[model samples]
Target: MTSTPLHKGIHPVLEQDHPYIFIDACMQAWPDADYAHAHRHGVTAYAVTAFHPWAGLDEALEGLMFWHLSARRHSHLGIAWIAEDIRHAKREGRAVFVLASQGGDFISNALHRIEAFYRLGLRMLIPAYSRTNAICGGCLDRADGGLTSFGELVVAECNRVGLLLDCSHVGKRSSLEIIERSAAPVVFSHSNPKRLVDNPRNIDDEQILACAARGGVIGLAPWGPLVMKPGSRTRPTLDDFVEHIDYVAQLTGSADHIGIGTDMSLGTYPDHEHDPWGEPAYAAVTREYDQHVTADVRSPLRAVEGFSSYPEVLNLVDRLQRRGYGEADVRKILGENMLRVFEQVWR
Candidate 1:
């Protein structure tokens, strides 16, 4: 007798026809992969990291333009400026693209650029990345100075333009301050919980509660060290990834505040050297940090068995089912939670 498929009678959330909304909270646009490959991944939406603190204003603009041009080149891609755009992309069987700035450096200290970038289809902004900026302290900064006057101004501008504020790479004090300051819900678009793994890039219990208190959702990142115990020789399993989700759920007493933001890039950092915006561009951004410090900043080089790519999201869903997560909760974790925040903040 032939065996039935594993997902054949699984929870509806694990079904391919369940109208799944897989959104990667953070990812880099690789020159080689392009939008064509991105559309084929079965992900409904992606928040592409078009700008970061390390890039100069001009380079940031270039990166934004590259995404714009790619969207124009690919018929299956459209910029998701609002929640409706995401719904429309799903309806049209295409991938919704949302540009995100990983740092305020994209504005070059100019406040007016917020609206301009919004018009250009940037839906999310992280006030700081890994170092101190005029607006706020970065996670790796020497001091957690919190949000500066200019940073408050940026938060206000982002709120005014309906841009979703992200606190992923921001320092603890600054992240909390931004959450408290913003009228809209804030997101740690691609961050893990520090309670699970003690890393600068991870958010703490207080931070997680603050974000949930503001009705924000924390997108669990799948970067190696963040997912697994620090310095573990073994790769993180799908269960390790879910533990972050479960921690946030149990901590917040609701799965509504948690979602996936696996910060997977097209390829490793070294592979981008041949691209137009390659090592030189990234190097300029990390010049202040010691060489050793900047070298290990990329996502974990090792691939987890079932948590490798977008399609592996199904694996996550299956694992969630095995873990006894209800279908509604699974749906929320898969995408509804993030979409709810998007609808609220992107208005």
Candidate 2:
């Protein structure tokens, strides 16, 4: 006899139906991937990151345009500019890929470039990534120095253009300042809690509280390092990932603020010579530092066990329910919470 799956009764419509919205808060679209894969995952929408920290304006456009052209060529893909686009994509059995920029450097101090990309379907942006830049300090920066004067301007511009502000790779101090400054609620687009995993890029209790206080959302990523403890080579389980959801719920007093940022980054650098390790910022990131550092982002670059891709996202609902999350809260954690933010922020 076969045992009943845990999620069957918990989320009856999850595996078979697509009535409710399901989104991947973070999806990578590199030139190397060279195709739209979100459609195959059964996800209703994705916020696609087609950029890197060291990429300049020219390189940034190339990445974004690569997807833009693919979406045009592919019948299954569409660029989501607003919440309606996502809804429509769901109705049409399609997946909408929203263009995103992970680093602020591509704008190169040209504030209007923010809106320019916005017009081209960029709905989200993280002003800094891993290291300090003209806009703000990053999580891996030697000294946070907090948000800069220019960073404040960037926040206002993002708000003005209705770009959803993200603090995933931003420094703690800078992230806090950004959350406080933005008229719109900012997001930790794809970060986990520091207390759970101790990664430098993860958010802390203070950041979580600050974000939740302002009606922001904390999007947890399924990256192995973020889910499992550092220095552990053991395969991370779904339980390990769900513990984070439980911790956030207990800490914030609600699951209203929790969401997924699977960080489903796929593809390689094409070859070793083209690897990002050649960059100065990435070099410092690999260096053993007392304050801000990374623990080999290339160690298999895998997701936690039982959650290898978007199709497996619903497993969280069952895990969460068994862990005692109510149906409404589990829905919020899966996708509703982020969609709520989208309706409020995006034009």
Candidate 3:
């Protein structure tokens, strides 16, 4: 399918009239059932994370292979290796699945693995998760050590191979270092604004501006404390989600730097016996780290009512229109902005 030229200031037609490009910049995994649901919801593509801190290289590779097999088995799903793949997915009425390493540990002490993963259709790489690793420090690291020499090599290799560098779970120093060090545009695939909600997982204004200056996009996550104030009894509404998007746009002076990454997995916690990623080993790490935060007080997955399902994306588009955002701007925030970054970096 061919894409219509993107026009600024024009109100976008309804989702049925103009095929909306909805891309989730980061998700833990997309099971077969989820892909069917996403296809029904008109989702163009998703960047699914294959690496977790709890898993070693072997486990990460296994996860990648599982997703690859799943996509091959599912007739409606296609693996996306470049920006045009997204447009193709839209044209074919299919969901484009892109793979990413949420933690750099997937490289397993080998820098060359970055290129290997790229060849395997892995498109994005996060230097760190919530904890520090040999490559870089994390936002939760006790001391904010910046990117290591190895981390620099990872960045260079990722840039060389056209892999999108993600700073969502990286530490402040490392995040800035990634922005400065990489020649290609970077992204905070599924992070919120720290100024809106005081969480280490969220990006501060300084971090947001630095990413924007480099022509990168910040995908506002639809997670709880990230989108709302702490201890608030009210479930996060669509307005709350839009507020974060609005915050990023106002801070950067352009809606072009904002996007969405739900970061929501298929199932709830403690029900991982059937999960593809093994027994949810990350749960133990989170249990230890969650005590210091307010995530339990409010659910991050259900931040926006109805967002737990894929079809609610249409609701988000409606909200954006009501908020006076032009259809052109809404399209950018929805997916075009992320697409632009992918095109720029995946050259």
For each candidate, how many residue pairs have backbone atoms clashing (under 3 Å)?
Answer: 1, 0, 1
- TM-score against native, each model: 0.85, 0.86, 0.85
Give a tens-digit lDDT track for model 2, residues 241-273: 998888998999989899888876444322224
> Residue-wise lDDT of candidate 3 within 1-347, one digit each (tens)?
22221211111222452468898898655342344444555567878877565577788888888777877878888888889999888888788777888887767688888888888888988888878888888887677799998888888998999999999989999999999999998999999988877776888999999999999999998765566566555556778888898898899998989988987654333233356666422313233224433344224334466454455677788988998999899899989999999999885
Instruction: Estimate the overall C-alpha local distance difference test score of candidate 3.
Output: 0.76
- Residue 73 in candidate 2, Cα distance off native in Å: 1.1
Q: Which stretches of candidate 1 lie over 4 Å from their true place?
A: 1-18, 271-303
Give the distance in Å from residue 264's predicted Cα in candidate 3 to where it truly belongs. Answer: 1.7
Residue range 165-256, candidate 1, lDDT tens digits: 99998989999999999999998988888877776678899999999999999999776656666545566677888889889999999898
Candidate 2 lowest-lDDT run of ten: 4-13
Candidate 3 regions with alpha-carbon error over 4 angstroms? 1-18, 30-37, 267-301
